[model samples]
Target: MHSTMERWSGRVAVVTGASAGIGAAIAHELVKKGLKVVGLARRVEKVEELSSSLKSEKGKMYAVKCDVTKESHVTLAFKWVKENLGGVDILVNNAGVAIDSSLIDGSTEDLKKMLDLNILALSVCTKEALKSMKERGVDDGHIININSVAGHIPPQDYFCMYAATKHAITILTEGLRRELVARDSNIRVTSISPGLVKTDLPPKVVLQVSPYLNPEDIAGSVVYVLDTPPHVQIHELTILPVRQRL
Candidate 1:
């Protein structure tokens, strides 16, 4: 194992949307590095299965059923982390959904759901994570937000609302970095904008795109940002497959 893998020995990490896809990949990577991981998702059974599959006893894994949009559930999940896993040193805000439809034809309810889950839930999770970091006196903690290339530039069409939420996340991560710096907190905030990751977005939207990147590729980028030195901050990173135009 590399030195970076050893660096995570005995640390605590909380990953939202960790039942499958990129979130699960990140949790797996963290465990490989010897960090205890708390997996939060709405699907209790799936998360439990993932947690149980981990091979290391030195690193623990816990699955917490949580609907990120609900403040009560999020609060409860974080509280459990504090009590059970010591305290969170790394928080990955990766729970998000996409509702793809032309703006004129998009259902208002779909847009609302996207905003609530993608933007609002991310904000709520970051807030709770910061509180835990402060309480633990854990200077030099990390916050990683999984943004998208759509956030950097507008999409062709039908992706307006989904892109909007990502744009908000990009802005949120930037603003959060400033706030932590002003408070003289050692918290590092980073946003990773991935281009066309191969996850189950709606089939209709997936059909419109070209080849996609793997979720683990995005996860690797995330680990890179998180493993950086305490004094350095990587504000924004964009990762895309070589053939990808966007």
Candidate 2:
């Protein structure tokens, strides 16, 4: 039997950095699939615009102003979800950045920003989401981390620290899975790694290749993963442009 999103209809989902690019696309797709979505981003107006545009979709969208690098912001965001939406059944940790710095000669501030947003922020969001899931007995809750192909490969010039942070995500995803298994919880954790997506996150000067993947492509992968059977778990999924040699 094929998997379907019927089980997740009307459920609540928290998507970080949902203002634009991959996060926006994922939020849009999830709303259309009938899941009530809360979009968290620093650019609150952008998310509000998206929510407004998606007014007639099968589900609803709420905009929350958030800077994921701040733990307090993430905490408040989840608290709001708990109070207003009961709890979150899904969390897409898509807030990430690729700095214009290198490991060898990178500014400490730049490296810290990458680490704080990509790794620390994701961990905190997972912790909050898991707490919400546990409190409400949501065994089928899913945590989808928006990772990058750089996580699985060596650093490439300017992406040195960014790659290091993504590598942390790869390990963190597995670590969370192990902890869930130890507790015998049915909650699922997934990492979706895409290569060279056409997004503002990556610097344009470094994109010297043709045929980059689009934000919608990653969004489609997220939908596919979420629609899988309850018995299925897609731990790691890597997507790349067909002709691009990584």
Candidate 3:
């Protein structure tokens, strides 16, 4: 068994935005590794379908219909995890959104939505997960942020606000790390920056990049980070396709 699989087996993990895309991929991988995995998303139907499909895996999967933007919903979700799966030992903050809106022409609603999901919701989830872990005395917990390349460099015209949110994530991850260190906590935090992954892209666009990455690639990295020894921390990792210009 892999280091992570060995250490994390039989533990609980909560993954957000797990209806599809990167979140789904991460949830699926964790389920196969024998961790009781809870998938949180607003689209319960889609997550339900995924649950049934993954039922045969080594571990178990439960679907929690949640709206990350709402604090009430996020609170209910962590509560559900506690009531059902006990507590979380790992949190994959994988829920994110990227809509087409520029700084100059952006709708207030659109920008607000992006900020809520991309930043606020993520912070709420982290806070809740930490509470659960602490309640259970899980000092060796891990938190993985599914950040983007835009967090490092703002993309072209239409992605200014999105970039701003990602930049905040970079700081958030580092800030959280510092706090954890100051408290002398064993909980580890890591951030992954993936460039141009083929999530909702068309086959034509995906094929344009000779070595474009898939959701599975990122999922594999998540496992790698968690698999490390308790003392080792993979602070930040960046992955990109060979053909990606940016």
Candidate 4:
């Protein structure tokens, strides 16, 4: 089992929204594979508990309190990662929120909140990660952006703002990939767009929706992307439960 983790023995990874659900699972998976992981989330206590439960010789875990929407918090967190565990080699931009309401009925503030956290924070974190990677001379770094099927095919009713934010993330991921490639950078940018995953969203939403993908299933896709060789870049991967319609 340990030998299987050799590929990631010396790598450093950072996962945002990592206190619970998919973010936490991704951090656990990476640490199991021998990558030192820094879990960033607003729920510091939860992330601390998560970090304490990991078991790996070559890999370690750290918990940082971060509200991704805040630029100063992100900056401080990244700086801490650099000072403590070395520079980041992989960054998982997974912090997000869901605000469901019809376009006309939605509060402007709510819409802005979704956009700020989902789209703006992702950009901030990516920029910071890229800067650190470049400065550290990590020629082959990976950035995994967790998007949603909502990004590609939006629902007919409700979730207008949430879906729009996701769409923006999709576009950003693609554009960043192009930019990195044009610059001849070895860094890889990938977007993992998943259908409704089983998470702690309001029960009403899940009850209305048919089948949802498991969080681990999405995490598996992330691990797969990271495990791929440097020569191959998986630009976009959309995953849905078999029973999902669109």
> Candidate 3, residues 1-246: lDDT per residue as tens digits?
336458899999899999998889999999999999899999978788988999889988899999999999999999999997788999999998887687787799999988999999999999999999889888999999999888998576687888888888999999999999998899999999998887763246545755668899999999989888898999999999776876
Model 4 ranges off by over 4 Å:
1-5, 56-58, 202-209
TM per prediction: 0.94, 0.97, 0.95, 0.94
Error of 4 at 221 (Å): 0.7
The per-residue C-alpha lDDT of model 3 at residue 109 equals 94
Candidate 3's C-alpha lDDT?
0.89
Candidate 2: pairs in clash: none
Error of 3 at 65 (Å): 0.3
Between candidates 1 and 3, name the one with more favorable lDDT: 3
Q: In candidate 1, what are the lDDT values of residues 1-246, reduced to their tens digit?
A: 132445667898899999988999888888877788999999978888877888655677789999999999999999999888778888999999987777887789998999999999999999999999999898878999999998989676688989999999989999999999899988889999988877777474664677778888988887788777677788999987778775
Whole-model lDDT, candidate 4? 0.86
Q: Please, what is the whole-model Cα lDDT of each candidate in the order they appear?
A: 0.86, 0.93, 0.89, 0.86
Per lDDT, the best of the predicted structures is 2
Candidate 4 minimal-lDDT segment of 10 residues: 1-10
Greater TM-score among 1 and 2 belongs to: 2
